[model samples]
Target: GGGGGGGGGGNTSHCAALTHIQDCLNLAFSTLDPISDRQNAPPAHTGYRVHIHMQRSFASNERTASSSSSSPSSYFVPTLSYWCFIPGMAFRRLSAYRLRSIILTSGTLSPLSTFARELYVPFPIRLENPHVIQNDQVWVGVVPVGPNGRRLCSKYDMRSDANYQDDLGNLVIHFSKTVPDGLLVFFPSYAVMAEIIDRWKTNAGSMASFAALRPSFSNSGDSNSHLSSLSTWDRISRNKFPVVEPRESSEFPAAIEEFRNRLGEGSKGNQERRDEGSNGPSSSSNGAVFFAVCRGKVSEGLDFSDRAGRAVIVTGIPFAMAKDSKVLLKKEVLDQEARTQQAQIVNCSNSNKGNNNSMSNSNNMSNSNNTNNNNNKNYHAGNHTHVTSPQPNSTSSSSSSSSS
Candidate 1:
């Protein structure tokens, strides 16, 4: 009986092992099938395209159980492997055909027509309501040139230029001095923010000199010339406490909390100054300036209303990298799809016009035949009447009839 029980346990273990192996085999086969067959598959109406990515990582751990004492071996390991069909496949799965309805709402859904086309879903009703805030509550402006009289361009090639970086820094400093309360400065990306901040730190002296200048000198005739000589760093620190967004997700909460604390302190200081009857501008009144990346944690899914964010300064347009694999692939797909749709529309229109022309030609031919038959009947009747009746002189009647 004990031997029988042991045999049963062994059989159960074998079955479990077989099941695990089967699952792994199924997963591997499924992944490979998609890669092999995706090309042969029909074009997805849901705007879905497969994206395959393989990430490699170097593993050099000396503490590994298999490592020898003499040498710490390093080897490249494939850390991640994934393939996905993206953009709207998931949403398409939950489309009106399957679900009762789909409603999309967002503040940033500009160019609604393009968005609807991409989703490949018919949005019969669309509303672009007025902003919730009154018109007077918001102010928008475009600054084409920097304080140093240089055109502000944040293109990839121009980003590394020392003069451009300095100009951008100076612009930020200028905003820090002018804008009250919390100032939100958004750079295109974290790399740009880091580069600009590094440049400012290196040229701290010129920034200090600029910050020391009185408000009256800011609007002087030589302000632009003076700005060309100056750089940026300590000006922001003197005017507004600087808070930077962190790259790591875990560090963001702390950064946000610090920003709030700084803003609160500035507000408190302003109240105290007002109580003392000093209405002049003070450093505390300048509040905190948050240096954040566009589309980062600070920019999206967060609110900084009222005193927390009195002004926002976007350094440049946050355009996607042209060389990015995903972006390039998506763009190519969209362009191809657009061309295909245009060709289809043209073909359909031409076919409809051809049918209409054929019908019109047939109808015109029938109408012309009817008109010719009526004219012939009238001519025959006139001749028959002339021959049958003779009341006046034949020549005179014939002449009158011809004249008539």
Candidate 2:
């Protein structure tokens, strides 16, 4: 198969489909055996360019149990998507026909130039509207180091470590105090979130420390209360003391109601202060804190406006795990493709500047290296400071909307 990682998993149907696609492609290629070679072709510079990308790394699919399927290991279907674009094709087709207007809109197409290229929209015009929220209302901050001054990272290897979890819990507690009302915390994945929560619950001291910050609720969708899940009933369990739990039935609704009340109360207080010519920020006591995983139900189509979503705290960069086999395969393929394209560009650029002296070429190469290094640094810095939107169709910033 072209992108063969999906074969190992327990998905027999997907494996068969992949095999069929590969066979069909092989037959088609055999028929076109005398096709012209475009090995040295310019990268989308002239005419049309067909780009193929493997979709297995980040594609969404259900995990099949090995016991229920033919394959022993669970694997994802490694599919290939092709983008064939010809410059000016849109204009040529439009000129050949009668058309009034062709307006395109998309929420995901933030960086318009990339979308334009992929869609072959030659000479495209783009416009964007301002985000809904104002700058001063939202705040975006980057906490590179934790309260202990250690690097705040959540990579697969370090995320499960005791020290890392402690630091993460400490950071969450610290942020909870500063952020008012309902503060939504988004984790990279559900597995990571569950691990951290389980560790804290198992450790009484850690649970006490975390509880002191705020009443943290999770969008786990598990209807059973945390205490109910316990098989044993001790004296402490019957004490009617409130405990933070990751379930809907366990104080989640009550927390939300309390948060709403606090919002109303806070608004009245702020109004009174403003009426008295005091421009100080108001504080509230009845608000709640919520924890959710990225791409979870709460993070997607939920409305967390006003007091429901005063702040959003992202634990770490939500990149895919590097240790996964699919991720490794994707990295290798992308790195190889990038190296080939970069080499072609470098060769073409150098050939175009053949008249330049050796010293000039060396200087140009040095400048390129420096630029690449700087770009890498900037990317790493930006990735660490990444934060999700607290509400749908809303953007966050401390000073300006673009600051986020």
Candidate 3:
């Protein structure tokens, strides 16, 4: 997460590395007596071992690479070829211009490369190693696909969480079309990764919220088993953040409207459904969990077993990725201190025109937007009627939505 040279002087890295080692040793001593630690060593310690040998070995190499530079110039994502790289590929250039896009500098999408090499590839074709091999095949085969869907999108968007936020402020569909149940994760932004929570608050406390529902999907690579999170295909959804601030009493109409809309939907449908909770006497079997996430907070680090107990609705995209890499870099430092691998996704998501390439992604949604007379005129409807068919399972978005 630390930009460019990774938090300055070589001393910093060495100190951090030593501190990490010390902490690990201390934790080992404190958690288990030496006698028991040895017995459990194979699973707990050995299992978590990584051959940072390469990373260590590369220190001098990296230093040499950094100092050996023949030219005085700038380096960006494409040059490092980190975020722009596919899982596997033989890198051919190290200059910034050679990178994928002019925008990116770091993130989950960045490629791990040997700055020591002329090209970013390994010193030799050690692609036989499983991680290397897989990465190579992906780079050679899949990476070339628009330099790979992940790298391309990541390089460009900056903040591209797949979670789909809904019109309702508080409810967002993590994986569209798949309605969830009980205390939902209100990602707002992973609920899109920005915190549309404010949007939810505005909706929850505003004067005009009509049957609002928000939804989203998380791309932290979490599996459903851990917390019943949705997969791109398994068709479930995931994660959480925080809650919404309840509205002032003046928000009654909006709350009432939301209530009326719920009643209308529940009553107009199946028989016993009228009593399905929110409105009538019984709650619908199809329920949702509500999670509230605040921008610029520890939303991602904490895990809630009840992740999506109900269903999450989003307010708006949460916080735009920070302008510089400071916050993300600090997070990386903290995660490392605790011997954890937290995802640090950097994004440039403040663009006004969000990418709208997949409006039809969801199967459940029949309508995309609620057309008013002014808006509908463009669609030739002549009258201001609402279009209600939303795409089902449309969990991802480019996030061009306003809190409205």
Candidate 4:
């Protein structure tokens, strides 16, 4: 009897395909001996290393009621990645030796020597031109204290404090009221931004109470009555429409469009007020405040020129979390490399000292030999003069012989 059943042909083909894939993977991995070695290598030797990361996720498809009662469906995904710790290696590969030339230009490339050293390349010719804009064109100021006279510190420990959050919110409110057009506020991270926004909405005695005290207005004539009826968030939103940067890439376009539209509306309102000869608070312009994370989409490449970005307020420095596995690994690798470089420099200095000592000793020996040779020549000359002619006044004969 033939062994294959109805679906047996499909199973055979799938098995053959899997076997072929396995063979290919084996051949590829066999060539990567260094990567194989790195699997067991210590942190110090992890300059160029491969990391295996495990990701667990639930199945996207919903399980049947019968199956759900038994166990949830989930799977583990393993990802292997190779990382190069030395940034200089990349630059060296693309150096003048391999290519014609490498040119790097940036507005923020200050401390050029450090940058060049890190790249392991020498920039023989360098130019640093003066800024195109004059001093008065740009204005920079640091606000040390918040509206409540509390020190403005966005350190991780202080971020969760009630008083700190309230003061920070108050600072934002103050800026929102005063700064016309679009205000871009950047937080350290998405998580931090979310936490601050949550606090602003929920904290009864903080932002809500504060907003209640401030007078708000509507387009209608009864401004005081309208202010009393609005909620805390409504009061803040009325002053300026808030646009938050979404976490998903798919939603980014929509968020950006909303921000731009709000800006356009605010600009139109400002023009109308000016035409009517109305002298009112800047908040009356109905500008938009964009809340975005530092180093995110908004802060990275997007240009918010003119009225789109009147002021940019940075809440905190966007430093990487120290506890992250990748960060820790990178830090360890850099430290080890730094230590190795320092050791090489010290050894080189010691070797140089040894060479200098040897040279100095040889010079001293040569000088001594020259002195002895001169003495020997003098002795020989004296003996030759004595042998050639004998005289009763030896001193007079010696003087005459030397003079001759």
In order, what lDDT does every prediction score? 0.67, 0.52, 0.31, 0.67
What candidate 4 gets wrong by more than 4 Å, as runs, is 1-83, 95-97, 144-151, 202-208, 211-232, 265-285, 321-331, 364-404
Candidate 4, lDDT over the whole model? 0.67
- Please give, for residues 88-179, the per-residue lDDT of candidate 2 as tens digits: 33444454465665677755667877556534444356887778779987778888876655577877778888767765665665555555
What does candidate 3's lDDT look like per residue over 1-404, in tens digits? 46646656677989998998887666444323221112322122211221221111111222111122321222333221112111111232233246643232222322334332313233432222223235533221212111012221222243233222222321233323344333333343332322333223222222112112111232334333432322221222222222222222343333323322332332332345544544332343333233334542323343323322223333334544675243454455345534522221212232222333344444225344433333334222334433333345974322232232
Which number leads on TM-score?
A: 4
Regions of model 1 farther than 4 Å from truth: 1-42, 45-86, 208-231, 265-286, 346-404
Which model, 2 or 3, shows the larger TM-score?
2
What's the number of clashes in each of the models?
0, 1, 93, 0
Tens digits of per-residue lDDT, candidate 4, 1-404, equal: 25656468879889999998888566445433332222442332246556788865655553321111322356889966555665665564465356767788977788899787656667898889999878987788899877666788999898888778777777777777778878998999876787777666655444434444443412334344453454334445766888878665666787777676666534554565576666442433477888899989898888898778889999899877788667987888779768977987999999999999999999999999986675445345543543223346674343334443
Clashing pairs in 2: 9-75
lDDT, model 3: 0.31
Q: Give the TM-scores of the predictions, in the order they appear.
A: 0.60, 0.43, 0.20, 0.64
Worst 10 residues of 1 by lDDT: 63-72
Model 3 TM-score, 2 decimals: 0.20
Ranking by lDDT: 4, 1, 2, 3
Q: Against the hidden true structure, what lDDT does model 2 obtain?
A: 0.52
lDDT of 1 by residue, 1-404 (tens): 99999999999999999998888556445443222122453344223344555543323333211112322234554433222333444454565357777889999999999887655567899999987899899998988876665678888889888778776777887788778788998989876787677777667445434434433325444454454454455556777888888766776887887787676534555665577667543434457889999999999998898878889989888988888766776777668767866987999999999999999999999999976675444333553434222345554234225433
lDDT of 4 at 104: 86
